[model samples]
Target: MKGLYCRADAADAQPKFVIQETSLPEVLGSHQVRVQVKACGLSPLDFKVPKSVVDGCYQFKLSDKKIENRIAYWCEYKYEWLSVCLYVRPKPEKLSSVCVAAALRDALCAYTALHTHARMAVGHTLLVMDGASSFGLMCIQLASYHGVRVLTTSHSLQKHTFLEQLRPSVARVIQVYNGSSDLLPIVLEETGGLGVDIIIDSGVRLQEEEELKETKCLPHKHELISALGVGGHWVTSHQDLQLDPPDCRLLHLKSASVSFLNPETWTASSAQQGRYLHILKDILEKMAAGVLRPQPEDAVSLYEATVAMETVQHNQRKKAVVQL
Candidate 1:
């Protein structure tokens, strides 16, 4: 198996990513299935996997699950779309992992965060803090598809046009320049003083530590308490958590919570990953029907994964798709 691999040369250090020929375990789990690897979504998870596992989630299904191929039309969601409200790196696409799954992996993660973790409903209002980023783009689209009023923030004016490709509802895109502080007023005003039902922060421009302390993330005692609804959920990406841990005490007042996306921590049997797969299968139909627009994909040759990964590292837009 020639795929991207990540392993720390030093035993005591963090794992770093590299592209090299790697072997897959000969023995397979009963639940696993081998994919032809026509295309695989490249994401941070690819580098973080500590093995040669790319987000080959594109075009694959678990052996035990009863997901009918699009041609067969097994059990699939009759609904127009499935919306999700949370955060980060694309999952592999449908059939393949677009969960044909590019940006779909990222979509699946958003779907999982919104549907499984946050318990998103049709009426829920989701605040996507980095509405223009690739991760944020999927979140916005899925939320809109499921009839959720999406409140998204974008700091980069240049990307606003691209963000519009996700098709957010009109007047819903809020521009925030000063990080959480600037976001305070916008969120408060948009949801009619009710705040957002959920918030998914996709590594948006984070404020400095001093600024973070001043803002205090929906401060427990401040004018911004209305930014987050009572008992709302905020799902921040794993990378962002290293820099900005949310204000726990402040969240406690409203009985709100902040969770990070770290699939590495969850056991295989845990419902968290299982639920994502379930969400993946459900939305595969939408991807096929064009209900959930596929985010732009930058396809690269699998043989050139070394160069492909460099693009993935600094990818500002377009989901990286590795064609094997």
Candidate 2:
């Protein structure tokens, strides 16, 4: 029944012991199952929780006694009648950590693009910016799995070659320097000047004083904005992009839509949570049956208990369990 707890020190500080061993609370009704967590993945946000809570900057707090044993996962109940549960495989201690992080990144990108940004119709084209990251590459694979044509970009020629091997569904791959504005013309030409159906901006944008310099030097932002067709969508995970409006007025001019994913708002709804669990069950069952092969035998691990948190910060990912 031992569980993980965030320490109030460095971002990557390891989990510490809670005052009490973690355990499932008594089941309130038939709708719930005490899931034993098999594996939980660490996210960037997971590393940030310690500082926020310890600094007294965090808005949410539980009695030292309550959170001493529990931290809330994304699943939660809205109305008293509803509840949610998610099942995930744990990462193994020895495998490449990037692979598991990539899996979650794929899940997030796939879910976000499929459900949030552009509806994935059978033949639609998806343009993924920064296509080399685990999230971007996974987005390409998932979009292709659903029959969407994917166009992705990478600054690394070598990485582009690697991605091409990974995603046969990618219709085209473009190589450019980071923040290169010159590539926009090439992108527009390749797409027949009509523009792409969707643009995913996953690259890092310069900020503060550096950002001002980038504005003068980089044309990727401008080119990206220009390349969206009317009614097409642009999506980004950039925090500054989320907080402030894009510099260009083209979205308003072209009636295009822009969306920012604040992973903080990523909690599943009651019904959606049910669906998520069902999907995970199917994934696990497939792996068990050897129908859907796992990347490797030691790809992930499973955990035994749940931890509760009052309010997790905006962008970190943490590992936890669903005790069944």
Candidate 3:
């Protein structure tokens, strides 16, 4: 089958992704499912090959589980179908395939970060950093739907305005300038000096030497700790994050907990696969009920996926889906 392939001369060398003919194993694993391509979500994950490619909307062609003809979530492809090792859930009838493809993974990440890791509850105040991001947008919407008050940060006036104009309307949209320390103060003011009940950041700056860059909008670790209310939870996506003794002491004093948001655990560990499928089902149901909305996306044709992928790879676009 023809698909997007990552070519590398050495294991340590950088992967060069190209659209070309590739082949899948004729044999399927015991737990594997073969998914016929419908559409593929463009993500950084797509730029690097994995043991399995599991984010896209597709139809089940063959599986021991007998889910054939069911439109489901997650898999990658080009001109032809590809195989996915993960399980499947029926796609929502109310939404198109591309729409479902764009929303599923981000919704999963948001749900895992807020509900799973942070244990978000109604009436709690949430500070979502970078509200313009697709994942951040999902976090805001899901929290808003659950009656949680949301305060989000934006780096530009346009993004700030967009966050303010959301249908449910964010409680506060704070514009953050580079090298500015205004976020903590604004968050404190909004919460009447108690800080927010939950803090979700895309990443956090852990060192003093780190430059204030506009690309990532990483909140300083100290600020995040200070911004958390007593007994609050901080959900972070930073994988290589490190904490110093002072960082630990501050968190301990406030009884705040930090949990890394790793969605791969669902597929990596065998015990979590059942729960993963359940989450997918819940996400689709929420989408069907209009409780969760898909993020804004730019759709591209299958042939255009080769170039469109770079946009997602370099973080130029958050939600780009390849329609087959």
Candidate 4:
């Protein structure tokens, strides 16, 4: 099998990825399938983070032999996008030969996190505190599919229009904010002061609070905490689920719940592993139905694989795929 790998020859040198031929298993393990490498998705983390941080997603799950970081379709089971996903569902070989189907599976992480961790329901509204993020973007769309109203915040003014345009018509996208901080009050007002049913912070909860250590920043953090409706569910990726005393008291009085979730832990348990596959199938179906937006694939050949990865690293969220 051919794979792109990160090689760090020296401790002081930054890791660089290069294509190399890899040896893989021949027989299927009943549960395993070797997806003919079709499309490989590139995430910003592909180049941004170190390989060790991501080893578990693909290296440990898919191949018994150690593989350098490159998963999500930059292609896992325990990571499944091996070449076999080419025809996981019905498809014309010509059309399926392209990377679109494999690219759609990239959404599984965000979708899985929201469904399992957030106690969301139809007709409910969620204030995605970090809307510009990949997870928040997908959450908005999937929630809309369930008939839930979504209000998202993106500090980037440029992204405001992009998000609105990117959102599917079926998604009841209620609002898109222009700034990250000073958003909770507007969020509360938008929901008629009831606050949102769920709040998803893409980074650690109240990460902005740690950035600016001034009196002005406290209100931003306070408003963020206050935006969680009475009994609303708050979910984010953080090592600590603890909150400041004031925020803690407010959530307590409101009977809201706070939970920490990590996409890295998506395949942690067997039950979650099963659910991940189901979600991937559904995402492919939705892409076919035009409900879910597909990543604009900057398809590259094996030799150009590094270029695709560079695109993801240099540019923030643009989707780049390497076709094998």
Candidate 5:
């Protein structure tokens, strides 16, 4: 058996990725399936894992658990664990880790919107922040497929123009400038004075070092809490809300719920994970059947691996794969 390892050699480090040879331990359970990893998707958090900010931002303890322990959690519960070891990389160009990420994003958006947010009801409106990217576009398509209206926002004018050309499921496109003004009014107007049933804020701003330590009133935090509908939900993979703004009564007042979609949460054995996996498998099948398309693969390589050191750093929006 073979695997990838994160190495530490100051001069040799180009980026925090590595590939290596290793032997697999004997299988200890009948339920475990030894998957030959063909490819795996690299996320921004993967690059940030080595940084000090990750220690405070993410949910899992990198130093406390083994890779196998984390994998077992995901296998048992089907929660999306970001801290997963790549066991096998599938063959062929069409089936790769990037495809898996796209599938997962599609599934997450679909499930969160239809089942969790809107309860899969027809005619519900979905407002997606930063809707031009891969995840946002998938959310639009999935929501539209279920007869739901979608409204999205983008920071880039060029990207917005390009998205406009695509003629996606979007009912309206708004370009947000200053954070002071209320964008909700425009969103409500687009929905005929009825506010959106759901609002997905993917670009959540985190606290600055000084503010994180001292401030009680953060502008971005307040805006987010105020943006939600009477019973809206905010989902993010970046920061843990429980630790931030503990005094903010928004969670109790407007029925606002904040959930962190970290890798650890994905490792839970709850029925939700099964539902997510089912949705993901279905999306992958759709892609395999040529019913869906994704962004082109631009692969990046991992140079080496080492224990005790962080594995990824400064990850931009790119698809990275390790050759084992």
Candidate 6:
């Protein structure tokens, strides 16, 4: 199998990727299937992080000659034959394969975070940080579909404007400019000082309260807790996030709860596997019905995957997919 391999070097911070040949697995689990790669999705998590992961969706052919279309996440390779667990679900015939590859996981993340973790309902107020990204956009659309009022934040004014004009309309689009303190204030103001019912954040500032003029500067933990209304749900992707005593006190005061949005848990635990496949099916059906749509794909060949991955890490593209 030929794959885009990432070799980490201690001398440099960035990992270098190259196409390399690796041996296929000799054995497969009873429930596992070997899939031929069709397209692989690239996001900040795949590129910015040092780990090598092919976050992909594909059309497959098993040993028994049975056919399936699957969206998979596996480490250490970009594309090739993959032995994936039963995370398989039927891809909607109406949706393009590249679209599924580019958006499936992110859409699943949004769905699980909002519906499962947050318990989002119609008329609920939602605050989605990093609202311009594919995941963010999906969160907005899904929430809006259920009649929730959405207040989203974008890194730039241009994206903020675009989000404001979205159909069904966004409640507000707050622009965070180079560490500007805009999110909390705007969220509070729009919600009439009550704050939002749900907050979905990609990442948060762990230690530093000091502002940095970086483009992708994350919100401070303090700000996140402060913007939660009473009994609010705060869903975060910040796995390493730590909360201070003050942060805890604020959440306590508001009777707010927090949940980590780790989609991989479904695959890691046996009990949730059935639910995982069900959700995958629902997401595909929604896309077919026009209730859900993926982010625009910047398609690249296998040869150009390395450069495309770099571009994703730098936030130069919304979403990138390796099309085979």
Please provide, for model 6 over 1-324, each residue's C-alpha lDDT reduced to its tens digit, 9 standing for 90 to 100. 788766554534566667887886667766455677788887654323322222343323445334566555442222233323444467777777799888887888999999999999988999999788789988988998999999888777777677777845577877776455777888888989999999999788776645554424578888889999999999998878888888898999999999998775554334665677778888888898988867677679999988887777666765688999
- Report the error of model 5 at residue 158, Å: 2.4
For candidate 4, report its TM-score: 0.68
Error of 5 at 237 (Å): 3.2
Sort every candidate by lDDT, greatest first: 3, 6, 4, 1, 2, 5
* Poorest stretch of ten by lDDT in candidate 5: 69-78
Encode model 1's per-residue lDDT on 1-324: one tens digit a residue.
676765545445544557676776666677554444456666543233432222222232356332323221111111123211221122323444333437555656777678766788888888876677666766777787788888776666666566665554624666554344556777777877778888876543343443453233322222232477999887766463433234555677789876766543332223345554456566665665666665465566767666565555555334566676
TM-score leader: 3
The local distance difference test score of model 4 is 0.57
Highest lDDT model number? 3
Per-residue CA lDDT of candidate 4, range 16-132, in tens? 767888897776564454555456566544222334434444222343332222133323211212211112443323234344533454456557556777757877877774455
Candidate 4 Cα errors over 4 Å, as ranges: 8-14, 23-34, 44-106, 129-134, 164-181, 204-221, 238-242, 307-319
Q: Itemize residue pairs with steric clashes in candidate 6.
A: none
> What stretches of model 5 exceed 4 Å from their correct place?
7-16, 24-34, 44-98, 101-106, 109-114, 117-120, 177-182, 206-219, 242-253, 270-273, 288-292, 301-315, 318-324
TM-score of 5: 0.64
User: What tens digits encode model 5's per-residue C-alpha lDDT throughout 1-324?
Assistant: 554443333434553434556765574344334444433444332322342322222222233222221111122111122233222112223655545543444445555655654463577777777777666766677677778778877656776785676565677777753333356577667766646666666655455333332122222544555556666666654454444545257657777676554443333323344554555556666556544555554444344322212322442333343432
lDDT of each: 0.56, 0.51, 0.77, 0.57, 0.51, 0.76
Q: Is candidate 1 or candidate 3 better by lDDT?
A: 3
Which 10 consecutive residues of model 2 have the lowest summed lDDT?
A: 62-71
Residue-wise C-alpha lDDT for candidate 3, range 1-324, written one tens digit per residue: 778764555556655668887777787877565677777777775323344433433233454454543555544332233434445678767788888878888999999998889989888999999988888888998999889999999877788778878846598888775556689899999999998989999788877567755434677888899999999999988777898899899999999999988675565445566777888888889999988887667679877887787666666666588888
Candidate 2 Cα misplacement greater than 4 A, ranges = 8-34, 46-105, 178-181, 204-219, 242-248, 263-324
Clashes by residue pair, model 3: 56-74, 56-75
lDDT of 5: 0.51
- Among all windows of ten consecutive residues in candidate 4, which has the lowest summed lDDT? 77-86
